[model samples]
Target: MDLWLTLAVMAGAVFLFVTEKLRVDVVALLVAVSLLVLGVVTLPEALSGFSNQATVMVAAMFVLSGALQRNGALIAVGDLLARIRWKWLFLLVMMSLVAGVAAFVNNTATVAVFLPLVLAATTANRWAPSKFLIPLSYISQAAGVCTLIGTSTNLLVDSMAREADAVGFTLFEFAPLGIVFVGICMVYLMTVGRLLLPDRGVPGSATADHIGRYVAELLVAEGAAVIGRQRSEVLPDGSNDVTVLEILRNGAAVRGDDVRVEAGDRLLLRGLWQDIDATRKSMKLKFDHVARDLDGDLNAERLHVEAMVAPGSHLIGHTLAGMRFGHTYRARVHGLHRRQLGIRQPLDQVPLHVGDVLLLDAPVKAIADLRIDRGLIVMGSRAQRKVDTTKATLSAIVMAAAIAAAALGWMSIVASALLGCVALVVLRLLDPDEAYEAIDWRVILLLAGIIPLGIALQKTGGAVLAADQLINLVGHYGPTATLAAIYLMTSTLTEFMSNNASAVLLVPIAIATADSLGVDPKPFLIAVAFAASTSFATPISYQTNTMVYTAGNYRFSDFVKIGMPLNIIFLITATLLIPRFFPF
Candidate 1:
């Protein structure tokens, strides 16, 4: 009866989590508290999860990731992407590279780094962000399959498995399935998926709704004043927004701007419209009005252009009317995408951020002058403002040392990462307030609340009972068949429950299955490990996917159309791959 009651309460909590009725963190904690009040678990056992090493490790990783991003460590890698002559091959290789990195880092960070990169890459080629942005986000989620530390859900499962059966998955146990799954995905994305991907960014946005319009490329004519000037000095007021989005020399796109601009070089300047014209009129520069004309009708001839609020862009959490962007930049207010649904209103009142694309209209001459200020991206071009990286060396060194120490096990991964955060503070690499703002407290709270409930389930013997049920259902078959059964079950559940919560629930069942078979638990455990982490069947399965769903302006069928096949691929790979690895 006690076990049944425990299961019923947990079922209710999961139902709430799956249906999105209550916040996940709230539901997780509610279950833990209910266990105590209903006598399902003792207070001490329920609360013990707060101190679990796994929770601390996950929390610490979040902070470290923020530190790295805040210190500009991840963005610095932007230089590594080489120019590709073939767009198809370029997209494939870039996807592989992004996936490889995500194999180690968190998925959200992967998206964070690559989202803007995709936007810049495609927009430069005159393709809409839609062609690659959704794919990038999708592939980044798939990257979690590559390794143990890649996703928090995986870590949570490993931790839970260890407690349940005194065993857990090995570091590379996922590689066989993951590599094959990623391989098929790569081929699909490069070919069929690419064709299926929408060829444009979202439209019908308010002034700031369309992002492509925000980025632009300009040409430096002969005898320009900035020809001999470095970015720091040429930047108006030394403001950070000024970015040299891209450079064209002799018809070739150059990623580096440190090279002095020569006569006839096409310059992609990411700045305000006012500065663009100021430079063109003041320095005798010209606009790539041809490029600008593609995304939207911006006639430098007529003196008008467009721009948007980018993801992680300084635009998020700020109102345009409050900041008086029009008054300060001398550009006319236009349409905004504004948060859709219940939050739908004009962008003039909406706060902007990294995923939002906005549309703006202003004088052609003013657009030309505004192009030099870095905080903005010209709608159709990829340009970066010159940053003073001389100080970046200190921040970089601190980050590297932290990673090395953690990887070498000289200190705990979380502790080493925290040390890097302190180093950033001492060096003043980023504002302390900025660092705090970057942490996603909602995710942190969700992880914290869910972890304790997992402890309760384990302590009350509910996990064992659940596992016994699964074993009895499938134990009649061989271990391999049982493994597939478990994988399928977890995958189906994850389509509704969160990947993290699902992992927590399924680990015990995996252990019980292993016990029933009297085999080395690694095989069954590996199946659970992989299954709980991959949820491509639905958009709501993972929070990261949900973020992309809204930003991409996609429908439920979009995920069903693209992600359903990916899920099928993962299931087959797991059923086949885990057995070969752990050898049940």
Candidate 2:
């Protein structure tokens, strides 16, 4: 009964995670509570994950990542990126820096800190971001496996291993395999992935050219000649090559081609510069117009900014008309660019999703205000401001010391990370409030909640049942076959679920399979660790993948086109190398 219940719950949880009907953290907590209600795990076991050293270590890493970003430490590297002129050399330098930093920092944060820099670089060099953003995400993932601190998934695996009374991985234990994967990925992207990536940074697309090319709502004046005319009469199909996305009547989206233009009706239009000008003159529309002050300061004082909506932003699923965005922010949203979906959609009616980039016309102050707003990431076209070298140097020193201490066995990895975080705070590199804010509560909650599900599976004998089934199918093929099977299964699960969750659920099974096979558990554990981090071939597969989704204007197939081959490469590498690293 317990095993069936556990399997049922796991199936439900997987379904919820893939469908995304509820927030991932919420779904995780629900799984924990369900385990308790089902009597699958005791209260202590259920709550043990929160008190685990690995969980604490992961939290501390978040603080460190936050400090590095907030202190402008990582931004300092962009200075070197500014000097590269050749495409291959540009990718080489960027990947080298990304891999070096991601080997210690969180991969998601690594991508976030470098996202703005890459956007600015693409704008300056006249290159498409599509050519670089996916590679950035891919390298961050590949290089992150090189160190225990590179990604939270590694920490979770190590912590689970320790909880099972197995020897945990050392700080640099995974570096050899990680370095090989990074090198292979770098070569593949430079030679093949380069051609597969689309040149999406087109002249009129907001992802590339964010200025002047806009889709705006235009209100016809009370005396305009187009009033009372059929929408077709005013905005005929392909008229001036301008597409009328929607007509807002009484603040609700009405038909664009069929409805008549009533008084106060707003028309949402998209077109090129000349087309917009032609349509404006022919229709006598009154679009959003910011007037210059008596001193004519509008052009100089106002700023046009393009910001991508972040994941978990309150703006998701809410239409701009419902949010009163213009009233609340005192800004005008000139355009909306969505991934997969083209710009022809009606902004006032279409619900917003994470990664949708909005172009806004606002004062310089509003642009600055967005820095603190968690809802958006600013993709600036202008050159980035100089990073504070003092803070950068201090942060680098503290980070280096922490890594050295852990590697040298002078302090535990968890203790060393906690000390580094404290030093960041004490040295005023990151303010106390900023440090707390730097932690992603969703991740903490997800870890704390889903970890119990692992305990429940083990305590309920579900892990044994799973191991037996897997072994029954592949045991005759030998332990080598079993290791590859586990790696493949874990990799597939990671594409549809959290990598951390994948690690937590599979580590015990891997250990059980190894023990049953009369082989070292280390190879199985290491294989699972590497496979969980190999979340490629889909945007939803990894956090960093999602981060670059809209910024690169890539479709779902783009990931598969580039990432599937890389995934195959890593899978083969892990299978062949694991036995070599940990003799079976």
Candidate 3:
């Protein structure tokens, strides 16, 4: 009954994760709670994940990465990349730089910091951003597997291995095979992968210009020239770029070319920003201000900027009007850009999702506020912040020291990371609030919530039961083939779900399979770790991929065409090399 319960809960969790009906963290929490209630795990075991070393270290690393980002340590490198003129050289240097940075910092942050810089460089060189953005995301994942601290999945697998009484990996243990993977990825991307990438966006156009068309609601104010004009007369087809999709009278949709525009009527229009603006001026229409009175001091100098809703942001499901976005951020959302989706609803009523780029109009001072908000990644040229060179140097040194301490076995990774975070706060490099905000609570919660499911599987013998089925299917091919199977399964699952969740769910099974086969579990554990950390088949497979999806103006099939081949290559490489490094 306990084994059945554990399997049932795991199945349900995977379904929820893939469907995305609920957030990944929420699904994980449900899995943990379900396991506890089903008697598959004790209360201590159920809650143990929250206090796990991997969870703690992941949170601490976020703070350290934040310190580096805030102090200009990361941006300084981006500034140097902006000078490269040759396209090929820029691609080479950009990939190399991003990979190296990602090996130490969080992969998502690495991509986020360099995204604007890459866009700016590609625009200046007239290169298609789609050609380089996917590589940037893919290489970051490849590099992340090079170090244990490089990705949260690595730490989670290591901690799980230690708990199972197997020898865990060192900080650099993954580097040998990981570096080989990175080299293969770089070569493949430069040669074949380049051909697969779509040449999206117009040459020499600004990133904002490539955001595609948007849907906006415009009000026909009193005394507007179009007040008495027929709908066809105002937005005549083929006369201009703008098209009126629908007309709303007193909040109800009204259809027909015979309908005359009224002073209070709202027009749902679709067009480019320039065309939209031009239409508004010519038709004497105004933006339907959801929060009209919130726009304080309209005379102040305002700046137009693009900002992306970051992954794990608190604003994902809320509407602009519901959140009173203009009042909260003191910025009016002019338009929204979503990849390959035409938003037909009112702008303020549309719920924000990850990677949705918002066109914001705000006062000059509010730009800083937008930059500081963790929920938004302000696109394009970053506003210059006062950088303290001394603090920047110290922050780098502190981060290096923490990594060295963990690598040298001076302290456990969790302790070293905690100490480093304290040093940053003590040195005034990061405030306590900033440190707290730096940790992506969504990811932390996901990790803390899902880990116990692994415990439940192991305790209930569910892992062994699953391992028996895998063994019956592939164990006859010997340990090498079984190892290959494990890698393939993990890689495939990761492409569709949370990589960490995939790892947590599979690592225990790998251990059980190895134990049943009478071989070392280290190689199997390593397979799970590497496979889980390097998802490349879909933009939604990893956070870094999603970050670049809209910014690069890519279609869903764009990732499929370019990333599927890379995923297979990585699978083949890991299967061939992991054994040589760890010897099954």
Candidate 4:
């Protein structure tokens, strides 16, 4: 009964996670509390996850990541990479830099720090962002196995191992396998992956080479052929080359479908400049002076900029129309860039979420005011500000010290990260309030909420039940086959659920299976660690993937085309190498 109850709850939670019907953290909290309410776990067992050392370490890493970002450290490093003249050399240097940084810092933080840098570099060098952003994400994942602190998955695995009375991994124990993975990734990207990467960024860029499309207002001249037509009728039957987004009747915005075309009506349309020019001649429509002269008016006293919605921003899950964004912030919303979708939706109707970049026309004062806003991180601007080099150097020193302390066994990963956070604050790299804001509370909540479920699964014998089922299926195949099966299953689960959640659920089962087979548990545990981080086949599998998804204007198939082979390679590598490293 207990096993059935636990499996039922897990099934429901998995459904919620995959569908995204509820926020992930909210789903986590629900699952944790539900286990307690249903008598599956005692109160203390349910609550213990909140105080876990691994969870605390993740929180501290967020603060350290914020400090480095604020102190201009990441930007300074990116500037040097951007100076590389050779394109191939530039890719090598950029990937190496990302991988190296990611090996020490959290992969998500590393990706966040480099995202804008990659975008800016591509813009400056006249290269498409698609050529590099996905590689940046993939390399970060490859290097995340370098150290215990490289990813939350490693820490969770170590924590689970310790709980099960198995040996825990040292700081750099995974380095051999991790280094090999990084080498394979570097070679594959510079060779095969480069050819598969799409040139989507250039076409989706705000400054496309051919001026493919622009959001413009056009005045409808009197007695045009399409005067009384509905907006849909104007572009009917799957005609998608041009779109009528909005209509202005007497200077008041109206929906394109609702409004009839009047003699002097103004319309907001998105299309190529050449198409607009041709339409103006045929339909007798003239470009609105205010829209055409955006540079002279909109940006004269204001700054035209792009800003990404940071995780846990108040803007998530709300539409600009509902927020009255333009009136509130005095910023005109031009468009929104979303993963896999590009800028296809109307601005007002589009819902905002984390990692969605907004193109805004706001006064310079508003932009300055928003610079410190926790809700949004300004990527770059037409007018740039100087970075504080002194703070950047100090921040680097503080991070290095923390890493050294952990690697040298002077402190645990949690202690080292907490100490680093304090040093960053004391050194004024990030203010106390800024540090508080920098911690992604969603990630913390998600960790705290789902961790108890691991305890529940073990205590209720669900893990053992699941393990027996696995053993019955794969026991005769030998330990090598068993390890490969576990790795593949874990990797597949990660694509549909949070990597941490998958790790928590599967790690216990892997340990139990090892015990059942009378083989060493270390090999199984190591397989879980590598498989959890090998989430390359889909963007939803990993946070870093989602971070680059929209920036590169990638399709779901793009990840499949580029990341699937990488996933297969890692699967084979782990299956072959894990047993040799920790003999079973």
Consecutive 10-residue window with the lowest summed lDDT within model 2: 288-297
**lDDT at 21, model 1:** 64
What TM-score does structure 2 among the candidates reach? Answer: 0.85
Tens digit of lDDT per residue, candidate 1, span 1-584?
66777778878988898776666767877877787788867777677556655565565555555555544555545544435546676677678777876776677766665655555565454445565655676677677877666777776777776666666555555666677767877887787777776643433323223332233345666677667665444435543353555456665665444776677776655544444545556656665333232333433444334444433345556777678776556665433332222222333555554344444556555565455443344544434434446445666577568767866768865577677777776777656775665555545556656665666666667767776777777777778778888888888888888777777777766776677678877777677667777676676776556555544555567777777777777778777777776787
For model 3, where is the 10-residue window of minimal lDDT? Answer: 202-211
Candidate 4 C-alpha lDDT tens digits along 1-584: 77777888899888998877787889889989999889998898888878887788888887877777766677767778768767788889999999889997778878877776777776677788789988999999989988888888888889878877557898899999899999999999999999999886453356442222445456777777668887766543433466776667775666744667877777676665446546656667764333232343543576556677766577887987788777656677654555533333445656776777776777777776566565766765322235788887888888888888988999887898899999888878888998887787877888889988888889889889888998889889999988998999898988888888888889889888988999889888888888888788887888788867756667778899999999899889888998888899
Order by TM-score, highest first: 3, 2, 4, 1
Stretches of candidate 1 off by over 4 Å are: 76-85, 168-177, 200-415, 418-435
Local error of candidate 3 at 12, Å?
A: 1.7
Give all candidates' CA lDDT scores. Answer: 0.62, 0.80, 0.85, 0.78
Better of 1 and 3 by TM-score: 3
Error of 2 at 571 (Å): 0.7
Cα lDDT tens digits, model 2, 1-584, are 88788888889989998877777888888888898899888898778878987789988988877777766787668878977888889988999999998998888888877887887787678888889999999999999999998988898889888888566899999998889989999999899988888887743456545422446677878887778887667774445667777677765677745678876777877765456657777778875443223223455577667787775456777887789777666677766665443444446666777777787778776666676565677877534445788987898888888889999999898899999999999999988988877777777888898998888777778787788999999999998889999999999999888888888889989888877888888888898889899788899888789878767767788999999999988889888888887789
Winning candidate number (lDDT)? 3
Between candidates 1 and 4, the TM-score winner: 4
Q: Candidate 4: deviation at residue 497, Å?
A: 1.9
Candidate 3 TM-score over all chains jointly: 0.89
Could you give the candidate ranking by lDDT, starting with the highest? 3, 2, 4, 1
Model 4 gets an lDDT of: 0.78
